[model samples]
Structures are given as C-alpha cells and as structure tokens.
Target: MSYTPPSWSPPGQRPPGPGPRSRRDRGLTALAVGLTLLVVAVTGAGWYGYGPGAGDERTRAADAKESAAPESTAPPSTGAASPRPSLRTPRPVRAPSAQELAAARRPGEAAAWIAADPTDLPRRNIRVDGPWTVGGTVVQALYREVTAYRLSDGAEVWNLTLPTPVCEAPEHAAPDGRIVLALASSGSRRGARCDRFQMVDLRTGKAGWTKELLRDPARDTPAIIVHTAISGDTLAVAEGLGAAAFRVSDGSRLFTVPTENPGRCHPDRVAGGSRLLVSATCALGDDPRTRYSQLRALDPRTGAVRWRHRTPAGRRVERVISVDPVVYTSIDNERLTDDWRIVALGPRGELRRTIDPRPKGFEHCVNVGIGAGLQPCPGVVVGHGLVHVGGTDRAGAYDLATGKLLWGVRAHDGRTLTPVGFRSSRGTVVYESATPSRPGRTFVLGEGGAGKEETLMNHPAAAAEAEYSTMAGRVLQAGGRIVVMPSFVTGEDDRRQPRLVSFAPAPE
Candidate 1:
C-alpha cells in the first residue's frame, strides 16, 4: 500500500526512521529511512531479462472487478423488499487501435501504442501522476483529472478536471505549459492531505489559481506530505510546516515559510531549477545530538535565506540532484551502516564532490517514489558539466568539476543502457536501450562525457514488451515520442499490464 497517502517521508527527515515508500501496493506508508527500491532496469532487462520474450505474450485483459447485482431470495420470501439491483460498470481496458498499433509494428520498430484508461477501477490506489511532455502534448495525472495526450497519435488531447485527489506534481511545466497541481485536501482513499493547489494550462486545459494550503492557520499544520519546485518564475512549496513561494506567472504570493528558524530549522522540501533549494531539519529539542539536516539557499524571490549547507551532525538531505550546480542525495545511518552519497554542490553552497553511486552498480541515488520532489533521479542526468548515471551501469558519468568517475558507456552488445536526457547547444548524452530484441533505441553522447555514441531511434520489435514495462521515471521523450507509462494505477493489474506504451519514428 505505498502510493503513500501520508507515508513518503524517508527521503530526508530521519532522526529515527521511516520515509520514502510507495512503490504502490495501493498507497500510504512512508517517512525517513525506508528507501526500498530495486528497479534493476532503467527500462530494459531484468523483470526477467526483460521478460526476454515471455512466450510472446499478447493476450492481455485485466480491468473488470465488478458487475454484480442479483441476489434477493430472502427479500422475495418477505414478499416486498426485493427491488434493488442496478449495477453495471465494467468495460474499461481496451486501448490498442492506432490501427492495431500500426499492425504490431516491427520494421526497425517505432510505432507502438497504448494510453487509454477510460476510468473504472478504484476502491483504493489511484494517485497516478505524469508523463508530462509539454506543448505538443503528453501530460497525465489521473484521479482528479489532468490528461493531455496527442504526441502525434496517442490522441485524447485535454482533460484537466481536478477538485481533489491529485497529490503533487512539478518536474517540467512552467516553461509556458504552466502546471502546478497538488490537490488532496481530503477525499481519503487512504488518508489524504496534500493541503491544496491548482494552476493549470498544459497548453490550454486552462484553470489558473486555486488555493487551500495554509501559511498560518494559527501556526499551520495541514500539509500531510507535499513537495513541489518550479524555479525561475518561482514556485517552491514544501510541506509539513515550512517553505513556500509562488508567482509562476500569476499565482502571486511569492514568499512565506518563516515562523522562526535559523537553528529551529523547519523547511520541509523544495528544489526548483536554476536554483532555489531548501530541505532544512534542525530536530529542535530532542537532541539525538542536535539532529541536523541543512541545505538551504532560498531567495527564489524573497524567501531569502541564501546559504546554510550544514549536514554533519547526523547527515540527512536525501535526493535533490541538480539545482543549478547543486546536486544532492545524501544519507548516513552511521552504526547501522548504509551510507549512500552523491553531493556535488558549488555555486556558493560549497562541497563540490562526493559521488559514490555504490561503487558503480549505481543505485541512481536511491530511486524514490510517488511524485518524489527535489528531483527524482530516474537514472539521473544533469547537464554536460557532468553527473549522469542511468539505472545501473553501461551508462555512467560524473565529474561536476571533480567528483570524477568520468566515463562508462558500453552497450553495443549489451543493449540495455538508460541515461535519458540532454542534447541542446551540443550538450550531448541522451540514451535509452530497452530490449526484448530488435527495438527500443536512442543514443547520443560525444561532448564532454566523451565522444561517439549516436543512434537516434529504432523502437519497434513490436514495442519491446511495451517498451520494457515502465519506470525510468516512467520514461518520456515528447513529440518525437517514447512514452511508456505507469507512475500509478492500481485496480490490481494483469489485464495484460501495459497501459501507456508509445514509440513513434515510423511516421516520417
């Protein structure tokens, strides 16, 4: 039950334990040192060598768990109470017709499809977040609504709905697509309480500013578990009782969180781009040796803090990974063992090198779950200044000035790499591999991380088992296409298990 309704707390706040949970068994149960991820594949291999071929699967059909309404014998005997049986809503699990997904494509592979849930299952575990591919469209949120699709043929274009249940989002959307959801003020599928938020416009589903979170309802206490970050136009937001900012083009407000800190430290979580970090902790008056967990540096328009950095009394700040030359991902259990590092900061924060992706089998800095904020690594990828580490090996890089480890890219015969972004102004380093055989490709490296990698697209072996299931943060790759899906969806699964698979490249 890990969609974490109140439990997703372990990425950073550990005076004792519990945090970072919700690979979703249905939601709720997170907070502190519960990391738990073993993803093993950025998108390819191991789920059983990529299910290797699984007897060619393709029967798929699990979605109906209801359709009952016929039982009135006792009422019949009583002669009157027998007149109430009207239930029937089980017909949602069909998606597969972009011309039968282009006749099950297989030529150099790249026209596969799927991403059509039509809604119908929910007794628990809904919280599906995004795939978020701006403008030409590709968003997703599901629960309170926010669909988008249409990256050429995925279709559906525009949904937006919300009134509750969306819990949190913010990975890429203000460059004009404008998003910033975070609902869940209370609808309890398992507890609810993300305080509240709105502001939409994924290229026009339109809905602008709606609020609810409190900055001081006497002293504020709503936020059950929230985390956001936008940067540039400032959006910030952290929860439990600290950190706030807004004004990403009209939400206004721009600064809050300051009931009194400095050593009282509270901040909860934030990590916008260009720079806006924050992740305080302080531990107040319990003294497990003064608790400690800093990494501030606000000022995303006056939330002003500037620089604090602290993290050596018990060490915490877990997972941020890139905020204008300030990477993150720390954790230090001490005597119980379990160290994990990745640091990197340096723009005025200090500490420019720590990296220890577990000696290189790379944990992608503890994976994270449920809309994880700061920056969910998903096989990491911070610009060419260096710091790239796909799900595991076969695609490494690090050296944000000297955290060293400079290179690792082998997959020509291995076929399962995973790195994912970067390529403008010649930054290079974009990768992907997935394999069931004969499809799923993406390459490009040469430039600082070191020369020659190039490939571009192949994607088709009938869509490599729906592009090897999901997760490399559910994979993206906008307009040119690469979709694949599942950040959350739990009616139970097994109806062939591939809800949103895209591939594209066959069109042109």
Candidate 2:
C-alpha cells in the first residue's frame, strides 16, 4: 500500500500543511520537509553538525529515511501517484488529537487504557516475541501459538497454534506480510533443535508451507536456530558457523553459507532486513592464533558476498542493531560481558562511526535470544538519520552519519522517555514515558526533534500499575494508540494485571 503520510500539528499549534494532492505533489513533500529541516538545524539549540554541509539536516534525514527503507517516497517511474505496495511502506493516516488529549485530562480512573487483554496465569514461563503491527493487526507469538489482535482495540483477530513454541522470528517481514518461523524439534524445550519451520501470512492468519529445514549432509549438523531476518523475498537463518537463505513464500532453499576456510574461518552470526549480513570468526597465523571477526554484506537473493569488513583483533561483532546501514556492537573477546561499543557502517560495509554509550551516559537494550542472538539490540531507535539512546537522567539523539550528539533532553521529574518511533512522519518523534506509580504519558517532540516535548496523551493513575507491568516489553505507538507488551511472558504471577495494554486519548 502506498504510504499516506499523516498530517500532524502539535498541541496548541495551528501550523498550516498542504492539503491532499496528486502523487507528484505528495512526492515533493520530502523536498518541502527538507527545507523545514534546514531551518530547524540552524535554529534548534543543543543540536550539532559536522562533515560537508554541516547545516544540511534535510539531506541527512532524507538519506537516513531512504536508507532505512529504500524508495519509500520516490515518485513512480511512469504512473500517476497510485497505491503501489512495492513503491513504499504502508503507514496509517492518524488524525491529530491535541484537542481531545487536552480536553479529557483526568487525574486517575484508568484513563490510560481504553482496551486490553484479559489477564491470565499460564503454568509455564513461555518465551514471547513480537507485538509486530501489520495492516492494523497486532501480532504476538508465545509457546505454541501465534495470535493477532486489532490495533485500535485489543480484540482478537485470529490465532494459529503450532506444535512447538516459536524458536525464531524475523524483526520485520516481507512487505506483503509473509514470515518464516522456526519451531522446536520436539515438545520438550530442553535440547530442542529449532529445525522445524513454517511460513505464515501476517495480514491474514493463513499458514503456508510447513517443513523441517534439512541439515546438509556435507555442511550442517542436526542443531540449528538463532535469528531469522528477511530483506526482500529471501529469508536468512543463522546459527553457529552456519547460515542459509530460503525463498520466503514457499520454503525453497536458496543457498548455504560456505565456510571461508576448512576450519580456521567460519560464519558466526547473520542479520537481515533491507540487507543481509553475516559475521565470521577467523583464526589466522596459527603460531599465536590471531583471531578476529568479519562482517560480510551478502546479496539477499544470490548469497554472494558484496563486501567484507574485518574488525580489529580481539573484538567480535556481538549484536547487530540494523543491517541496512549496518549498526552493531562489538566487545573484546575477553571482556565479552562489558566494553560494549556501538558502531555504524556505511552502505559499502565501511566503518562509519562508533559511539561509546558509557561515556555518553546512554544505555541500549540487549534483546538477544539464547541461541545465535544476532541483530539483538532493541534498546535504541535507529532511524531518521539518528540513533536515539537512553540515559537515566536524559536521552540523546546521535547522528547516524557523524555519530555526533544532536540533542539531549532531561527526563521529567517522574518520567523517563523512550523514543518510540517517528509517527508524525514530519521529523518530530513520539515518546512514551512513565514512572512506576505515575500514569503513562505520550509526547511528541518538535519538528526535527529539537523542541520541548508536548504532551499528546496522559493515562489516568488507575492504569499506572498496569502500564508499569509492560515496562520491559516493547513500547510503540500504532493507529494512534500506545501499545506496551512484555517482550517475554514469565511464570511470575501477574496478579490479574493486563499483559498487553493499549492507551488512547481519553474520551472527551
């Protein structure tokens, strides 16, 4: 579906925006948006610039947005602006709600959540993944089942149960909503190999080809599973020293990652999404046994190496933050648990910049799995030509191109900001923040992420505890609702608290 950029104006503001137009005018929005960025870049305080054209915030933001999702806003080659699914990512058109959010303000009374899932106590601690929003459907997988719900209201849409709990899922799926998931080899979780697989259409609850990934007699063993990522039509699964790509629609093997050397160098981990990357560990010069890790950009369909980047000795690529412009963290082999450095790579797999979160006073979330665990950093929001990092006292946005500090905002007296996503589609960012006893708050920063955050919605105190329960889960805004769900559901009692809750503007 062609993207319908949302028309948004912050609270207490009446800035004018262009009215509905033809495809060409819509495409020109980017240029107009860029001009706006230039003005903000020069005037916005606490912002920084570097490299050629330091004032060209428009170009940088545009480049970052395009790089994250290519051809997102480019005009069609010939046809008049039409609803072309392949041309751009689909985005919902959310109405401005500054008035309602302000008019219905309440001190408490569960004002935060208008809808939620009924609380339940499951016997075991089931591993949960997702809250992925697709075509207005919010989906989640836990134990042996995958379920979808309406984004507007937490109402069930459909459910698909698997023989075994899902062992792996991609961060994003094909533009058409197709996804391949790996299941356990057996019902028992102990020593289960995630070889069984299935493809499902996220939009509809239809299941596609389901089969077990065959281990190559010549290359792979009976064991498998880590992270699964999809670029276009190809899905790549990575494990220890093994990586393979397959056709996304129907489970067809594309290619197997070959070992670089008989035993010295091998594939270690892989990451996918708009790009495919494989990390390899190589032991060279046997006398002292020098070791290092290499990141290789591979063609999603052909499995051909497009480029390779070797890290300094003793540092291995630990987690992949993104693959398009390649963001990752590497640590010294000896200091595996510490010394985490966030790095960004150019399109050519060249090292672009690195940020040490410790010195910057920011922290990233490590949402890795028990297995391959690649592409695991979810703590920071990577987009809009900047990476949003979180620090206890304040949060900062770092330029992905220059790695320079852009702007930092101190947390409110009782709340912490978590950059959710660029929902406004106008360069301003939306954030969800709250304290344990305080109601959740939704706010949007000024255009270019430079101005003070204006409150968009505020939940009532009655829902504070429920909102806090999902603090560790993914928090994002969809269809004008703030969704907060646990990343994983454990056996710990919920005390009948809602596990998945959505907060919307209070009814006026």
Best candidate per TM-score, number? 2
Question: How many clashes does the backbone of model 1 have?
Answer: 27
**Predicted structure 2: lDDT:** 0.58
Candidate 1 residue-wise lDDT, 1-508, digit = tens? 0111112222323433323432331231232323212221122211111110101111010011101212222222111111211112222234456786587664455666666565664543344567777767787876777888777777788786677667678775666778778777655544455666888888878888787744346644455556887877778887654667888677777678673454477776787766778786676444434576778878787877787787777666767767777887776523211355778877788887776655444443423432245565655767767777764225666667767665555433323355556766344445464432223467665543434566666655544544444323356666666676655454544332345777766766
For each candidate, the alpha-carbon lDDT, in order, equals 0.57, 0.58
Q: Give model 2 RMSD, 1 decimal.
A: 18.6
Extract clashing residue pairs from model 2: 108-461, 112-460, 143-165, 365-379, 473-487
lDDT tens digits, residues 1-508, model 2?
0111122222343233222343433333444345334422432211111111211222233223323443324332231112212113322112113243334445432233323333342544455567678998888876677788777656688988777667677877787888888777776645676677789898988889997665555644554335577888988876545678889988899998787856666775677777888887777433212567788888888999999898877767877877766888776544342345778988788888987654444433422221135655644667767777643334566777777765655543423456677655333344454443345567665443435566777655445545554443566668777777655444434322244666776555
The TM-scores of all predictions, comma-separated, are 0.33, 0.71
Candidate 2 ranges with C-alpha deviation above 4 Å: 1-122, 216-220, 261-263, 284-290, 366-372, 391-393, 412-416, 423-430, 446-451, 492-497, 506-508
TM-score (C-alpha) between model 1 and the true structure: 0.33
